[model samples]
Target chain A: MSNRREIEREAEHVLRELSKHLEEIELEETYHVIDAESLRADSSPELRRGFREAALSIAPRRDGAHYVAEAGTWV
Target chain B: MSRQALGEAEENLARRFEEIERRDREINSFIELNPHAQEEARRAEKLGGRLAGMTVAVKSNINVRGLRATCASKTLENYVAPYDAVVVERLRREGAVILGMTNMDEFACGSSGESSYFGPTENPSAKGRIPGGSSSGSAAAVAAGFADAALGSDTGGSIRNPASHCGVVGVKPTYGLVPRHGLIDLAMSLDQIGPIARDVRTAALLLEVIAGSSREASMLDVEPQPYSQRLSADLSGIKVGFAKEYEEVTSPEILGVVKRALRRLEAQGAELVEVELPNLEKALPTYYLIVFVEFFSATRRYDGRRYGYRIEEVCGEEVLRRIMLGSYISQKEYAGRYYRRALQFRSLIRRELLQALEEVDVLAGPTTPKLPHRLGERLTPLEMYAYDLLTVPANLAGIPAGVVPAGRVNGIPVGLQVQAKPLQEQVMLNVMLAAEGRA
Candidate 1:
């Protein structure tokens, strides 16, 4: 099974590719972060860990689950 | 053109203003008609393109910055929004003037618009018939010609139901197509803002302007292929699938009209296929459980804290019913049994719709099974809730659906609902155009 990380990576990669097709389209912003603990808080730690693993596929982690990227990072 | 256009269109404003000013008295349509719409309509004439500076009425649940977003309930009766909802911001950014706010069921819990604190909005159809609620005023305003178009929130059957009863056109875009930021959500997973108008073209035009990705509504990250395009090809070979079980409980007059519509489509070159969905049996019970739990949870912020009046003190029957139901469903061990079952049922419905659309192009049915009910007849709550049976499945499926005036029965209008697969709005809309004689 391609885990959830693989899925997010694939989605972000396809979006970045699609943005190049048109001029003046609103590809000016793209923000993808997968933080299960801050968003859910009380859920299972394992589930949070799973989402943390998924985050690795989308963006490089800074500290813990927080990740940030500039708008229009889809290039 | 800009401000100069308002100067030019000044002559056209007097007549539209007088008509809205006259009819809104009886219908309870506008919470507040913008004092500036007439003044702005003059500027609108300078404006060009799709909307042409047309004015639009917004639902009370959506924000317009400093305007009140009471949601027709006492709890938020005094509330003023601090920011525009993404849709409202887009409308202004695109030059479609915001006319004013319209009334709705408190927290969008009712089917008859009777739960609004502003009082039950009179249906513009039969004097005694319900305008079919939650989006009641929004529908009544469009039918009475108060504005060119209005924005309404549909959770369950809110938008399509009223459109059916009031004899207008309304479209709920595919979920996440329109943004949710600053919408006082009735149910987060199901509520969507869409255009209600006199024709499908206007609905499509508004959808085109609003159907794009937004940063605030993170789920709305991908822009849809522009929704306004009308397929030039004939609908002759398109397949329409309908559940035969839908025929079991609907009224004869309403069913007769919907059947006639299907027959008309058949004569026009489209092929009709009979489809069966067995899981449909659990849709109703499941719908309430989810709505009740979510509604119950969403109201926690209204404890006389930030917004309007305290809920129980001023809320009407429908609002009270939901709060009470939400409390009961969320109590003790009943939480998972009631709420989770509903979510599971929602997933099942989504699966069935996706599976059915695999072979058929669209699903065809009466937007509502029953014609508008009499205004004062006493009925059980469940009887009223049953009106949503045909419509909620489409919302749960996260697909685009619309109701156009199919025909009249017993002097009230009936709607033909057409639904397409997730994100396949242009396809379904083409089919609706064919049924509405636009083809």
Candidate 2:
């Protein structure tokens, strides 16, 4: 666990060093925009049910109608 | 097909299954065996798809119905894929029988194949060494003859690095050239699912079968071409770029092997031009920034409710480190300085590679800077990230790049990487086909 802590700290140190070089690069917001055209195929209820069952079959805990998860701290 | 041919196909598959059962424990290449593989081989006789009787090993991160699509992490160790990935569906449509899922780095986070929860996958080429990863198991399985070909994803050097170490053929097709509908993304912008096989022609055939515009994914609009068709061994008219900067980061043994391969290409009448890709040094840090941020976003789905475990609790050191770094860089205060700058650097990298490609048909270099080391050998995260130095620029540029086994140094394999412009897999494959004969 201490090794994990060391690795995390090392990673943060490297990121800060990397950010220092960002001043050399020009500021640009022109990120590559992806084609948002949807090619999603509509699935039938049978397919939907199969996916639901597949997920539910392996859920750590589940009620009949829903997957049971640990209560959120925020909520 | 004749009955005799069908029988031969079945016999071949049976032998492969037997080999896996007998020797796979030592290599740890495969994670699961497709229960329906035998049935699929039988069905191949009646099918008319291009890959009618081929056996393909799929990376476990890509969904295969009825098999768990674990990213070699405990987080999804028991999560069964509800459906086939688009690539898998395409392969099945072409009548390729899926062998099973191969192992990988946890959440596709590591360069060496040692980070898997199932345990490290041993290199088939060098007995005690690691298999370069995150496509580690895919390359190993192909090298061990457990499958005719395998599918692997390259976010950076994942596919080609393993292919190089395993002494096999692997291609990382142009970003957005192959559909990523089912690939578990390490970095959404950089991830490309590609094919690995024993020979260039087989890899090209598998790529042909898998590459196209998908109904649910954005990909290149170009008509799929027969990449393996009429590939000429003669390199008379081809211009090959040799970047001098690659030698600075590459080990002497690997550089020797790659230089010799370049010489062979030169002998075949290829014009070797000295090219400069000055932005190459910046690719490593740039690649990591994008990957960490995107992977952090991708892994948010694994909150223990839908997957096998909460990633933060059960993931490996590499995965946890990336998540932490990603979370840090994504804060609004740091986003402009780190993530946005990385994107800008990525654009600069793309322009540099494209400009180089205009002068040459393809760029040639060592796939990885060094050979695989012994499993469990200690390497810092930056040292591990260095493995992708020679291979990441292609991913950043969104270009087609492939690895063909060039030669071996001291019983370990080195690969010659051939990179071409986006959607120019044909050029890449031809270079690979020529190198396959020489290598």
DockQ of each: 0.02, 0.28
lDDT of 2 by residue, A1-75 (tens): 558879778887778756665566565577568887865556723346487788888999988958888756774
Query: Model 2, B326: alpha-carbon shift in Å?
Result: 0.6
Determine which window of 10 residues in candidate 2 chain B has minimal summed lDDT: B1-10
Pairs that clash in candidate 1: B5-B42, B5-B46, B6-B42, B6-B43, B74-B309, B75-B308, B75-B309, B76-B308, B77-B308
True-vs-predicted CA distance for residue A70, candidate 1, Å? 28
TM-score: model 1, chain A: 0.27
- The local lDDT score (0 to 100) that residue B405 gets in candidate 2 is 95
Model 1 alpha-carbon drift over 4 Å, by segment: A1-75, B1-13, B42-49, B231-233, B437-439
Runs in model 2 lying further than 4 Å from the true structure: A20-75, B1-4, B332-335
lDDT of 2 by residue, B139-183 (tens): 999999999999999999899999999999999999888999988
Pairs of residues clashing in candidate 2: none
C-alpha lDDT of candidate 2 relative to the true structure: 0.88
How do the predictions measure up, each by TM-score?
0.82, 0.89
* Residue range B245-362, candidate 1, lDDT tens digits: 7788678888888888888888778899998876664566666667766887888877765554567666666566666667765784253445655565677778888898887999
The local lDDT score (0 to 100) that residue B118 gets in candidate 1 is: 83
